[model samples]
Target: MAHITFLLVVVIITALAFDFTNGFHDTANAMATSIATGALRPRVAVLVSAVLNVVGAFLSTAVAKTISGGIVNDGLITLGMIFAGLVGAILWNLLTWLLGLPSSSSHALIGGLIGAAWVGAGLRAVDFYEVLEKIIIPAFAAPLVAGLAALLATRLAYRLSGRADEESVTRGFRFGQIGSASLVSLAHGTNDAQKTMGVITLSLISAGALPTGSGPPTWVVLTAGLAIGLGTYLGGWRIIRTLGRGLTDIRSPQGFAAETASATVILTSAHLGFALSTTQVCSGSIIGAGLGRRRAQVRWSTAGRMAVAWLITLPAAGLIGGAASAVVVHGGTAGTVAVAVVAVAAASLIYLLSRRSPVTADNVNDARNVTVNPQPAPASN
Candidate 1:
């Protein structure tokens, strides 16, 4: 029993660590466009996002319940399996952050859990049907829907204000961004924070601390909220640079439209208990906004890279989780300790590498240095 308690404690801590990474990693989802368009200063944006994230966590537990009960068979999950899964998720989050890639933290967590569960208790342990219904379908659909909404919103904003003075119109949209961006932050808290709560609750159930089908406890919600909030406050500058500048140039009007579209999609999914990817939604919105403007150049190369990252996120994280689970199951407590040490070491190395070419609030929006040379076409003759 004491051993189980210790393992549960480890799993809970690791789960919170993953939540923290999720916070920073996806910070760009809410505030990137606002910062890019100068609607909000980078620091101010993150601060607001952090606070709203905590508030959003308390909104509902429908997503949390889905995670704790929907994806995998609770009866087969163990504390070690949960720990291994979190380790996989955290590593992937850190790696992607270091590379300035805005991959889906939601996908990372889900893939990790699925992989660890499968390895720990065979293929039968996973609920493929639920994964399809809840995660996969939403993963593909949410972004497309949000993108269409943003495109229309952007077009409408332009059409409605076409006769107005350009400077005044820009100012108005910048002001509007404050509210729309805040909504995205709040929606993020409600959606992403619940993922950690669900993981912790699942651990408790596996350890017999909570009954199966139970929702996250009050303490669980509070800690998960705080962990993600703190991460958001710190901001993920590398990813902010990528999303805010690397994808496409954003104006105040487009920022407003993109953020509003993202918030609506995220909030709707949260209400439905779908573990949607906020990063994908925001990226789609930004791209849609870019396309909505006449003669706007969308950076297809950067977008292509991001799409590739999204495609591989699940399988890559799943492989790592499966390997970690196998190690833990074979080597017991010592194996768990080894995995922890390795994860910490890898994370530290990535951080050090990131520091070599750091992206900070001071220069996050400076995309003037970026140059894309167009390929010359072969001579027809």
Candidate 2:
């Protein structure tokens, strides 16, 4: 029992580490557009996002319940399995972060869990039907819904204010971006932080520290909230650069529209307990906003690469999780140590490589010409 306690402790720490990565990895989901449009200074944007992320984590546990009970059979998960799963997620989050690709951290966590569960206890351990109904369907549908909503909202925002002076209009929308971006931050907390809570809860249940069918404990919610909040404060400048500049040249109006659309979709899914990808929703909204404005160029090449990352996120993370699980199950504590050392080494390397072309707050908006490119072809002729 003491050994089980020790393993549970390790698993919990690993889970929190993944939550930290998730926070920075997806900070762009909430704050990118606002920063791009100068609605908030980069530091101010992340500070607000960090506080709201903690506040948002307390709003709902429906998503948490879904994670603890819905995706995999709780009976089969071991502490080591949970640890392995998180390693998969953290590595993937770091890899994508290095590339400035806004891939889904939520999907990486889910895929890692599914892979570890499947490998640790065979295929029966996973609930494929629930994964389909809850995760997969939402993954495909949320982005499209968010994109269309943002497109419509962007058009409406423009049409309603078309006769107004351009300076006044931009100023008004810049102010509006602050509020809309905050909503996205709040929605993101409710959706994203809860996944970590679920993982911790699942670990407790597996170790008999908590009863089955239990929700995350109060302490679990608090710590997970704090960990993610801290990470958000750090910000993911690379991804912020990608979403704020690489996707399109966003104006204040479009930034406001995209943020509002993203918040609505994310909040709705959280309420419904769907573990959809907030990254994809925000990215799609940005794309939709780009398309909504007349003559705005949407960079298809950057977007195409992002799409490819999304498509591959699940399988790639799953493979890593599966391999880690196999190692843990067969090699025991030594295997767990081996995986940890390797994950740390890989993450350090990625961070070093990222320093080669660092995207920091000071120059986050060093504008890229999305229209006439020295790089990929523009979406517009």
Candidate with best lDDT = 2
Expressed as tens digits, the lDDT of each residue in 12-95 for candidate 1 is 999999999999998999999999998999999999999999999989656555454468776687788888888888999998
TM-score of each: 0.93, 0.93
- Stretches of candidate 1 above 4 Å error? 61-63, 66-69, 211-215, 368-381
RMSD of each: 4.8, 3.9
Candidate 2 lDDT tens digits, 91-126:
999998888899999789878988998999999989
The lDDT of model 1 is: 0.86
Question: Residue 331 of candidate 2: its Cα lDDT?
Answer: 84
Clashes per candidate (backbone, < 3 Å): 0, 0
Local distance difference test values of all predictions, in order: 0.86, 0.87
For model 1, the run of ten residues with the poorest summed lDDT: 369-378
TM-score of model 2 vs. true structure: 0.93
